[model samples]
Target: MGIIDINKVTYEYIRRDEDGNVEGITTAVNGVSLNVKAGEFIAILGHNGSGKSTLAKHINALLVPEEGSVIVDGMDTADEDKTLSIRQTAGMVFQNPDNQIIGQIVEEDVGFGPENMGVPTKEIWERVEESLRTVGMYEYRKKSPNKLSGGQKQRVSIASVIAMHPKCIVFDEPTAMLDPKGRREVIRAARALNDVENITIILITHYMEEAIYADRIFVMEEGSVVMQGTPETVFSQVDMLKSYRLDVPEVTELAWELKKAGVPIKFPILTREELKEELIRLGKR
Candidate 1:
């Protein structure tokens, strides 16, 4: 079994009235099943209300499944005794860094998770040091979070999560609030975490560009995984992705458009260099 295993999980959102009446119900996750091995990079893409976030919640036991189970490293999230362990094994980083960062300083913020976990004072600082360093934020450890940019703050937020020493990290649109440069910084940090620390990463994002680096991409729609494959394979189906209310990366889209316009190129060009190479090949032809 993988480090994270979700088996036929279903979750619903219940609406209620002021008088505690049954108003309505929305099924956010519908029989979703998938697995993630240790130290793998996975991306989940979906439009708003697609239930990707809801599924992410299950990884750390934020929400137990209504009809199925989420198991992390052999521990069932539904088991109350395993809740803390599940969270420690699969830490989450949210979209907005502002809401997540609460410390007066960067290092202080990063230490919160370990401190709460009852780690030794000496080791808490050690974890804070390593986590910030892993995210390339060690130099700014003593700086006030308010003085940092969006991307820097997000990195700190990520450091906070990693300080917990989670086996896996789930990022819920972690770059949604940043500018282009900030987005790049945050994404690069995430890649570093996977490459350097060998931590399992589950990124829930709408930005297709971010998904390009993932080992595999899973597209969600109506609370289920509609497509799952390598980035190249999934982005190759541009029209199908569009039908799901999502998009391919920019380079992929351009190549797709060129193909549609009668250019003798392949589908799902993932990078600028690949598109360039293909055009050069066509020119030579």
Candidate 2:
């Protein structure tokens, strides 16, 4: 079985009035189901309020499905006894690093997870060191989080999650609050975790460029997965994605435009390198 199995899950939010009376109900997730194999890098994309974040919460048990179930590493999220185990199996990193970082020093922040888990003090420090190194934040271990840049702080947040030693990490728009460079830094750390550590990565992002390296992509619209495929397959349909209020990566859009202008380049180009190589091949022809 896959590391995560979401079976026809549906979740709703109750809107209450000032008097605490029910106003209406809105479905955040609607009968969505998918699977993620161990060690796979998955990307979930959507506009705001598209239910992508809600779906991510279910994976980490931050929100339970009202009409379906979520299984993480064989533990049911709905089972109170298994909640802790499930959380340990799938750690989460949120968009804002300031909210997640609590310790005065970086290393202390990273060690909090394992320390809270009751790991021996020695092992906790060891885990803190390794996790920081994994995310390229080792040298900053002694620095205060407030002294770091947005990118650095985000990396520290990721290190904190890594120190927990979870088999999988769910990134819920982790780069949304950062600048372009910061976005790249966080995305690089995430890719390294999946490539070098072989950890399962579920990345929820609005950035099309970040989704290019994913093994698979799921695009959500109005609380449902409207499209899913490899980057090439999914981005090739630029028109379809636009209809869903999504845009393809910059290079992909350029390639699509070139193709429409009667160029012989590939229909769905992912990177600048791919576009250059295709142009060179066409020149030789």
Candidate 3:
């Protein structure tokens, strides 16, 4: 089994009326199954209400499956005894940095997780320092988070999660509210965590550019996984993705259009360099 295993997991909630009457049931996660090996960087993409967030919540035991099971590091998320360990093993970084960060100082906020876990005071400080450094926020450790930019505050939120030393981290639309530069900083921090710290990362984002950096991508629609493969394989099906309300990278879409125009360009050009290389190979430079 991989570090994270989701087996036919299904979750649903009952919609209630203002009068507290019973309403219809909405299934948010419908029998989704996938796995993430240790130290791998996985990306999940989908339109809103496609069950991406619900599926992510299962990894940390925030939502128990109504029909199937979710196992993280061999611990069933349904097991109450293992809930704390499972959450510690898979920390979560939510979308809004303002909501996630509550520390008076950056370092104090980062240390909260370890302190809550009953780690030694000295070790908590050590973890706080290391986590902040890992996210490139150590220089601002003593500063108030309220004074930092959106990206800086988000990095501090990530640092707080990592201080718990989770084996994996699940990011739920972390860059949705940031500017382009802030988005880049968060992605860079995530990549470094995977490469340097060897932590498993499951990133759920709407940005195609962010998904391209993942080792693998899973596309969802209506609470089901409709596509799963390497980035190149997944992005090549431009029409299929569009049918599911997604767009490929700009370069990839341009290459696809050129291919349709009989330009001999590749269909899925993920990066600018790839498009340039293909055009040169075809003697169109």
TM-score of each: 0.98, 0.98, 0.97
What TM-score does candidate 1 get on C-alpha atoms?
Answer: 0.98
Worst 10 residues of 2 by lDDT: 260-269
lDDT of 2 at 34: 92
State residue 220's C-alpha deviation in candidate 2, in Å: 0.5
Off by over 4 Å in 1: none
Instruction: Write down the lDDT that model 2 would get.
Output: 0.94
Best candidate according to TM-score: 2
Per-residue lDDT over 4-122 for candidate 3, one digit per residue giving the tens place of the 0 to 100 score: 99999899988889999979988899999999999999999999999999999999998999988999999999999999999999999999999999889999999889998999999
| Candidate 1, 77-152: lDDT as tens digits | 9899999999999999999999999999999999889999999999999999999998889999999999999999
Clashing pairs in 1: none
Output the better candidate (2/3) by TM-score: 2
